[model samples]
Target: MKNLSLTPFFILLCLSFVKAQEVDISGKWTGNSYFLGTQIFTEYELHQEGNSVIGFGTTKNGSDSSKFRLVGEIKGQKIFLKGVEYVYKVGKGCLSKAEFTYSNSGSMATINGRWKGTMELTTCPPGVAGRVDLFHKKELMVAEPVAQSGTSPQMLQSIHKDDFEGTELVNALADRKYYALIIAVEDYNSPDIQDLDNPAHDAVSLSKTLNEHYTFEKENTLLLHNPNRSEIITAFDELASKVKERDNLLIFYAGHGIWDERLQQGFWLPSDATLDSKAQWLSNSTIRDYVGGIDSKHTLLITDACFSGSIFKERAVFNNSKAILEMYKLPSRRAMTSGALKTVPDKSVFIQYLNKNLARNTHPLLSAEQLFQSFKVAVINNSPNGQVPQYGPIGQVGDEGGDFIFLKRGSR
Candidate 1:
């Protein structure tokens, strides 16, 4: 007996039968897919015109969820779809290539195929393949649109100004000042506390960028190099006292950080911190308390140290509305970190992209979320060890779904 289970000519055979039926693959498509022998749920809203097919989809594998933009072409009775971009992802996600064969039994229409992932797109999972079994949801009313607006809300969450709807939202911060507290701990007094090469230099670079390009003035931006635990708290206290309720505050930290798994806490090591004890280490909870004490309308915390992402707890991330100005209306406590609960490099690829984006940005009122998302993908792709950057609202820190807006010097 000869085994003809499947061959490379499968796609060719599907194409021959595809011409028998007219293809109109539009509207909702929901089904199951497999990768690494594990089953995953997928939902797509597709539109097909002529031979071109375009859509967006949400896929879930257990607790992990990701939204991807789809682009494909209809081949006779078959469709070849590829994930071009990841609009949103909860964890490590990569682009996918899928080929589906559409078949109708007069009562129901189903598409079956196989999907593969791009290993280089994201780390870990390497690359794998599995089967795709999808059924079209046939609820006809001429045009079956995904949303009231043609675009999905997933795309709207993107930080680009051009992607937003309506005019810019007005920010009444003309009388207010943008205060920045930059703390970079590079030189450690204790041998136990590892010294970093880039924090001090990074602090200077960021201060210059803020003063020259953004609304933050030189006098308003305070730089602290090799600050002890006391000095760090003193800096926050000063900001709390000096900053007005309408003012905005930006806190930037770059140095060695660690997560105390036993205590379920995270800390930033000051220059004087010792390995024997966490006495001189700055606790994230303490920082959160200090951040809450500040009356600033918006607070943006940028951390470029290891395990910096631990600042957020049950967080709500950036989701841009129709107008840009809506970002600054409510008081917010937002954090932008280099990577999630992982050790980052000393030289700092995160800060490099961050500064580059800030310098090149011409937008008069750029939100902190916009700045972070613009270079997030680049940081992930360019990082040597595939570090995943994080951005979200800090818990119990007076965050009201607003964001810190970076005003360009001459744009306004």
Candidate 2:
């Protein structure tokens, strides 16, 4: 007879092995890794076989870059890897270590860990210490696709103010160009909310005005009707792709909007947004982020929807619009909302006044500040509910006492 002992150490080891086998980490992991004040795009292509894993990490910046072979093992919920970092600057390898704790909830996968090593970049001295304490996630971790409505808006055509050629003062404004993205969502997929009137019509009317009156190249004016949340985001992304640092960008939206009283946040409801499915709603903070990411010298957001005022409460720059020449020298980010966190009628008195004022004004260049102030007075006088408009510069959003000048005849 042979005597066999089942020790506690062996029991724990078996449990760890079982846990590691239950979870699969056999895919790509990507994130931004920062070291020595430089951001490095990192990607790890990993393969898991039993409890052992092997992979490679590729990092690059401009012409400086390197790749490393990674070897690691999974124990319970933790992952440990070791490698040698080959620096482009030093032309030699240095020791590196990474430890991570991973989790997956259905399709959403995330891994957070700490990495320490030596990395020498072309911008750094020699033997620069590198440390990355961050999290990586599976790519394209977007929410489930929302139902789309209407046909996809056509891509904006590139337009240039070639009228500048051979004109005397055209040389003065030659360095500047104008771009506009106008969106209107008048219908909804959700039955809980009723469809609105005048959004799509208003967007069309505004687009025509911008193109004909403001010298916005008809090709460059992008007008979208009844766009989904993703389409709205993509519209901005496309606009950003084409604009330059010296250009001015204008965005206008007219649709259903909601405000979270508990969270003190506002959201722009897309055509597919449902009361039950909150993820379909686009937050104002996200719009702010997108507006900030644009490279244009001046950006203005005009919204005619409920809770639009909430977007600027915290980020309002109180300065008045500056002189034309001085304003052109500085940057500006401003907004004019229809109303605050209250119900806004579908008739859209805000845009009505805006259209009337801009159309009738004889000013060669109507500043955004002037348009906002005029609308505030007109909306209060006309709306039975006294839905006063809100206007201000976006705080911390690169407003520098400048104004968005809408050129009436393309010359000032």
Q: For candidate 1, lDDT tens digit of each residue in 1-412?
A: 1345565467777876665556778767899887767788988777777789877777898779887778899877779998887655777556778889988787777889988766655422434778889898975333333666566532111223232221222223444699999999999998766677889999999999999877788889999999999999999989989997778899999999999999988899998899889889899999999999998888999999999989999534555552455566677998999988889999889999999999888666688888888999999999998998899889987898888887776432
Q: Please list the residue runs of candidate 1 whose C-alpha ends up more than 4 Å from where it truly belongs after superposition.
A: 1-171, 315-322
lDDT values of the candidates? 0.80, 0.73
Pairs that clash in candidate 2: 315-395
| Candidate with maximal lDDT | 1
**Worst-scoring 10-residue span by lDDT in model 1:** 162-171
Report the C-alpha lDDT of model 2 over 49-74, residue by residue, as the tens digit.
77888766667666755666677998
Taking all chains together, the TM-score of candidate 1 against the true structure is: 0.59
lDDT, candidate 1, at 283: 96
Determine the C-alpha RMSD for candidate 1 after optimal superposition of all C-alphas: 18.6
Q: Evaluated with TM-score, which candidate comes out highest?
A: 1
